[model samples]
Target: MNERLLPVLDLVSSRTADSAWLTFTARLDTAHRADLRTARRLLAEFGAPTTNPHEGHDMPGMVTDEELAALRSASGAAFQRRASQHVRAHLEQAIRIGSAEQRAGVHPATTALATKVVRTGSAELTRLDRLDRTTAVNRDW
Candidate 1:
């Protein structure tokens, strides 16, 4: 999820003119990237590969190649709208997955990471929700 989300967040930050949205995306990008790094390191310590098994799968909030192309092709408002949708969906799914991992995962480090993911993702989701509401009221996109 972080792997997928990072690039989209980067794209959105580059395209969005809204200062609030930029700030939110930038912070999220930093946190998610850190999470991904920690996760990869944890897997490596256990002799497990860090490669994503969900690649090309139609899982919830998994962004498609076509969607990525659309995002890449779009400019300004179009990009912002598409990127916002993708980011929000990804955050929601990540929180859900993280919560499950926290409950079911046996590894102490992995479960700890999951707990952090859930906490951070939930906070960011609230921030995203507020940004969405503000954008909707402004209708600037």
Candidate 2:
């Protein structure tokens, strides 16, 4: 087991948890509101194992001040668009970090956790895509 991978896993899990928190707190439309709540619950459950005990470590993939401002200020379709983009980016980062952990030959527990994160991320990406398509179709009417 690579000792270095532990921090990576912790960082990825923390960042994912943070993203879920943001999504759950955001004022999303009915289409994604329930999903975000579910996502937050799952993230908190899965990400708990990898939480770093050390303080002051920067959370990777943390939303920038500007992005937070934009999301907070956005409304209607703009908010949906920004949220979608933010979620997609967060999933992508999780997938990448999970892959790295797998490749690093970390402990079986870590590998299993990483695998779960990747699978969850992929599913979320698919759901987001479906939601985007549905929104586009509705807009055509």
Candidate 3:
């Protein structure tokens, strides 16, 4: 894993809850039939890796290739490329379609969670270089 991804790993780990699971579930609900079945199995195994003693750290925030493949299948090929534009936008697109069909409530919360999931997408690490300066320069720790 890239060092830059650590913050995202930490952020997601710290914040994960029903919303995160909801987003994950939403991804499943929207995924292609072929990909959805496999992704669920893989994620289940990853989430409960019998090899790892520590439960919390066992499954980090990183997305696997399988997950990406599933995401692409769910979002479509064109979306696969367009998703690089912004995580929030891509996820919003997913939620727009998924939630509307699935009838998930609390639109505001779902929208917020979608933003988080998108920000944590793979390139999110690379995006930090250009995206962080503004916040870093303004904030004091």
Candidate 4:
């Protein structure tokens, strides 16, 4: 198993179909629908060990039951804040792991996937951050 890939795989596996993830997806605007779908597909791909023979064994940073409970209970802006924070942290970790994998000279396929994950995750994070800022500004008025 690629050490760099483990954290992301674990996160994906833990989050897929989980209540918090479902709630987050449900709350997202139509503008974010495509991105949410892409993220889910990517997570499914990473979570399936049989689909990627090189991957097995769990890693750190899997979302806990407690965190899911919190997300489930949150509403409106609070939900967005919580979901955005989690997404940002996940993206940041993916970026770091992907960069490390690139530096370490992993398999070309793995490297490519890592690159794609980082790029897509970064874009999503930026979009979410922008939305958050816009919401905050609107609330101040």
lDDT scores in order: 0.83, 0.53, 0.36, 0.53
Count: clashes, candidate 2: 0
Candidate 4 has its poorest 10 consecutive residues by lDDT at 1-10
**Residue 87, candidate 2: alpha-carbon lDDT:** 62
Measure candidate 4: CA RMSD: 8.8
List, residue by residue over 1-141, the lDDT tens digit for candidate 3.
222122222233223332433344244233323333443455475564534343234134333445444444433223322222333333344434444533553545444443443344423334433333433344321
Candidate 1: what lDDT? 0.83
Candidate 1 vs candidate 2: the lDDT winner is: 1
Question: Between 2 and 3, whose TM-score is larger?
Answer: 2
Q: How many backbone collisions does model 1 have?
A: 0
Instruction: Give me the runs in candidate 4 sitting further than 4 Å from their true place.
Output: 1-61
Alpha-carbon error at 3 in model 3, in Å? Answer: 21
Local accuracy of candidate 4 as per-residue lDDT tens digits, 1-141: 223222323343234444444443443333234443554465576674335432343334234456656766665556556655666666677678768877784457567666765676677667667766776676551
What is the alpha-carbon lDDT for the whole of candidate 2? 0.53
lDDT of 1 by residue, 34-140 (tens): 99889889889999866688886877777887888889888676777788899888988988998999889999999999899889888988888888888877876
19: Cα error in model 1, Å: 0.7
Per-candidate clashes, comma-separated: 0, 0, 0, 0
Candidate 4: give the clashing pairs: none
* TM-scores, one per candidate: 0.91, 0.57, 0.21, 0.57
* Maximum-TM-score candidate: 1
Which candidate number has the best lDDT?
1
Flag regions of model 3 displaced more than 4 Å.
1-38, 41-122
What 10-residue stretch in candidate 3 is worst by lDDT? 1-10
